[model samples]
Target: MKKFSLFGLKFMFEVKRSSKNDVELYSTSYALREKIIYLILIMFIIAFSSKIGLLSKNNNYSVGDVVISDIYAPKTIVFNDKSAKEKIIENMIAQSGKEYIYSADAGRIYLETFDEFFDDIYALKNNKDSNVDFKNLEKDTGRRIPDTMVKDLLSLKVPEIMKLQKETRKFLENLYESGIIQEKATIKYRSPFDKKIEKLSNLQRQVVETFAAPNYIYDEDKTKKAIEEKVSQINDQYIEIKAGTLVAKKGEILNERRIKILESCGVYSYKKSLGIMMANLTYLFIISTLFYQIIFNRYKKDILRKSTYRSTVLIIIAFFLTFRFINNDLIYLMPADTALFLLVLLTNTKYGLMMISFMLFFLLPIIDYDLIFLVMNIASMTFGAYLIKKVNTRAALIAVGIQMAVLKVATFGLLSFFSEVETFGAALKSGEIIVSGLVSGMIAIALLPYFEKTFNILTLFKLLELGDLSHPLLKKLSMEAPGTFHHSMMVATLSENAAAAVGANAVFARVASYYHDIGKCKRPQFYVENQQNGENPHNRVSPFMSNLIITSHTKDGAEMAKQYQIPREIRNIMYEHQGTTFLAYFYNKAKALDPTVTKEEFRYSGPKPRSKESAIIMLADSIEAAVRSLDEKTPRAIEEMLRKIINSKIEDNQLSEADLTFKEIEIIIHTFVKSLISIHHVRIKYPGQK
Candidate 1:
């Protein structure tokens, strides 16, 4: 036995050369007709969404447009007159009186003034030493008192002066209590003792005048606050515009109010132009035709073979319907990136870009051709398609979404900056755009699994999940048929390397290879890879019976894949990997036993590999088994044997259906040989006999 390693998987058995070719690509007249039908259906969906309300005309009149007729509202409409309401509220507020809040210490100020006046008078009456001086008495009282009055008061007896002071204090206190003596108010007091004081000369009169002082202080702040509170109490008033009312007369320039009323009434006459409609339709037709041509010419093979084409159309229509029925400013929140992401995931980046273009061309009219919206959408789609090339994990998908959001925000910012609208409104619009981008990404990511499951499509994320060795079927295979499991792993490694070299889906190739031999688990003893004992099962059966058992694995694998709810692409590979090639040993054995046996009877029933990944897996599956079977494990011998196997497959028409050019095939062969050489390298021996 010879030992060899390929992509780090060690093998110690003779290689089994498979005679099956890669699956063939099929496109019949019915498939072509179906493509046409799907295209037409997609066109109708676009047209229906586009042409809705096409007959309704938009008013193009601005401020200068003269009203020819007295346009009235068709229905009773209650329009908000914001300006009028604001003006009314402002006027009411201006006319309203202010509220006044009295100071908490105002009473204390009055009390202090009264106390000072009484103390000065009482001190003068008693002839006691006091701080009140006659010369400065006017300053303290805020009024002038005669010098003669002070001299006369001091000359009087204590009892007479005391009685006069008591009477004066009582009169002043009464005046203060009357609320007439405000802190800033002037009071002229004519005392009841004025008649009596007339005999005492001008002294008493001067004292009375001096005693009268302003008591009430004006509070400017409090008064102003009161007025403000009154103003704030006024409510906004509305003006109703009645139906059948003349919003604007002929030759009357439209003011803001008149314009608002006219808009509210839905009053405007639009010129019906057939030429414009025809031009729009022509534009739609040209763009739609170009879109159809792009898909038909570029992705015809991928689309025609399955429901992917229909699914694409359906996805587009779903978006169209969303735009049609859900009328709102939030139409920007439509996950346009979702379509781009799906297109990139399902087909390629080129198709994704084309989808963005198609969506913009068709949806712009529906969105009223907003240039800012178009720019943002384009930026979002472009980044989403480019960034989400291969989403193997949910986290990677989220990261792609974040990238799209950042790009969208940047695009919106640029648009806002160039528009020269630097107001808060522009900032708010930018925020909305950013939010829409983020929401779009989330929706796209959230809907990815559903889309994959619904369309029976194999996304890279789905492939990763299926590729996990922990999966129930894979685990079962590993436990039940350990040798076969190892063989599948080796085949997957080879397929993945070849796929990457040829620029194919390496993940899909690897995942498909993993479950390709699952059917062998059903009859582990019959397959040589799983046979533990040296007894060959084929020795006990006829060549035809052995051939039947061998060929049935492909069918059985497909059935098991379906039972496990595996994706259609993987199931397809399982069915087509062995591509109706002759089982040489069994066919030859049968021919030796009976000369009339047909070659087809000993062949594996297969539809053949249809895609590049499937074809790569088919080659890898055969190559891995064959390389393992070789007795000569030298690098050069292995390379020569690999080339012979490839050449044999090509010569046998096994690679005919594979979409592989000669250049790509060469690269794949080189990659395979390099990987095998690394695995089969000769080890240095120390003092050992050859």
Candidate 2:
């Protein structure tokens, strides 16, 4: 798990155990090969990913955004320029003059009305002694003559009154020639009428205000007729745009007018397609990197046995791809829950969850669902993944699947209630939807065996089955080689304890221990453990011959496991349990006879234990035999013997390729000592037994 950073990203790669030259180090080429394979897988996913959600014929265009490509008129289009036609009619109306009816009678009436008003003032002036009422005189005239004007006129002599009357007649004549706007009896204060009125003295100004009116009528019928004639002269203007004519160019900002034109030409487009594709590219890369960090780093084992990696890749791709075909009604049935359970069983719950977590990011786009469905699946998948972690039987798988089904339904219902999904009842009530969660457990059981067999993996169920003592291989060892069988059982117990203490594969260690010495069954009498008569076969043979016999057992055991169809890891354990260490008994026997005897002549040929399980079993095998051989059975003797044997294996470099750290090795040694002491502990003697 030690990591190094490159740029800003931290990459994870398992550091090598002890020596790079060790025969069992994972080959760099295999690592490279798997990376290439997974990269191709990522590329494949991205290539088809557009179908997942990307749209090439995208229409999410906006005005003012640059065009992606040149838009052309699909067909010839000829249409009227309505705005241009309206402009032409507006100008014609501006140039047309308004018709007005002139009134000569209006002039005479104005003069006579003022003359009468002046005569009233003179009568009031002459009748001052008779107490004449001026209020009555003002109302008789249809004018609001000011009191000053009336008072001035009343004070005027006959000559002044006649002169004011003449001036009023002149003002009326000017208005009659210029004409007033008499529409609604309101005055038109236009140029010519205002010129004469503005030059008036105070007295004449009063006369104009009281007497002036709209002498020029609007003449509505005449104006309406004139506008009709001007509009009739105008015609609809049109223009033709030919097909293939470039309406808009790439990189040009689209206006509303251009957008309408593109839509009419059937060519609206979005430039953001490239951006979407890039986002997808980044998405796939991050997930692939995460898979390498979480799954591959932890589970990368033998190059020859790559089923773990392949199966994970296969299952992930299959589950996400299936989302494409899952109907909305059956979305709850998406084997996401099932896929997750099987993945956890295939690898482990931890990495299985990580892979599924990445897979869920893409679920929304692939299924075209919102976060409600995504959250629902996450809740359901995580529940199923953890729920089935302890499942080891087909029935357990089914039971967990049933639990998952109920949880999926309940999760969907809650999500619907909170999110207010209107179709909750219809989607929930369907038998297919309700049972979707069960597929998590059901499909897992269905696929578990196939993956275990085809991929040569060890799921919990498979390991449990192998742990059964009644297995055919264990039974064969018991019948033909009882003593070796008993020794193997002790070794299995010791190996399991050591492995568990070091966090190695304890179950695999125990199961593999049962068959590690199966080759001894073929030559039961030659091996010390199986010789019930307590005979030493080495006494009957030359030391060289004895070395050959002892050394051949490892190779013979490996072949036996191969024939029994054991997994590659266990087969390796059978082969490597005996490292290339010199056989001291046979070598000493030969050296006593000849001083020149070489150490190589009595060594077992070994590739060495390469994995944690194999290495644990190797240590356990040596420690179990060494401790059991103690004549005094003392705790001090046992402890010293444990360190001696382990030191010898270390000196021989048997554990060099294994991933056991110094601390883990110490823990294994301690665990084996405790377990061995317990097993070999003396029982209390009965009082009368002797």
Poorest lDDT segment (10 consecutive residues) of candidate 1? 180-189
Model 1, global lDDT:
0.70
Error of 2 at 278 (Å): 8.6
Q: Give per-residue lDDT, candidate 1, residue 289.
A: 76
The runs of at least 3 residues in candidate 2 whose Cα sits more than 4 Å from the true structure, single-residue gaps closed, are 1-305, 380-389, 399-411, 426-434, 593-595, 687-690
- TM-score, candidate 2, is 0.60
Clashes of each: 16, 5
Provide TM-scores for the models: 0.63, 0.60
Which lDDT tens digits does candidate 1 get at residues 327-413? Answer: 434555565666776677766677668765677777765654567778887867776777777666767766776677677777878
The best candidate by lDDT is: 2
RMSD of each: 20.4, 16.8
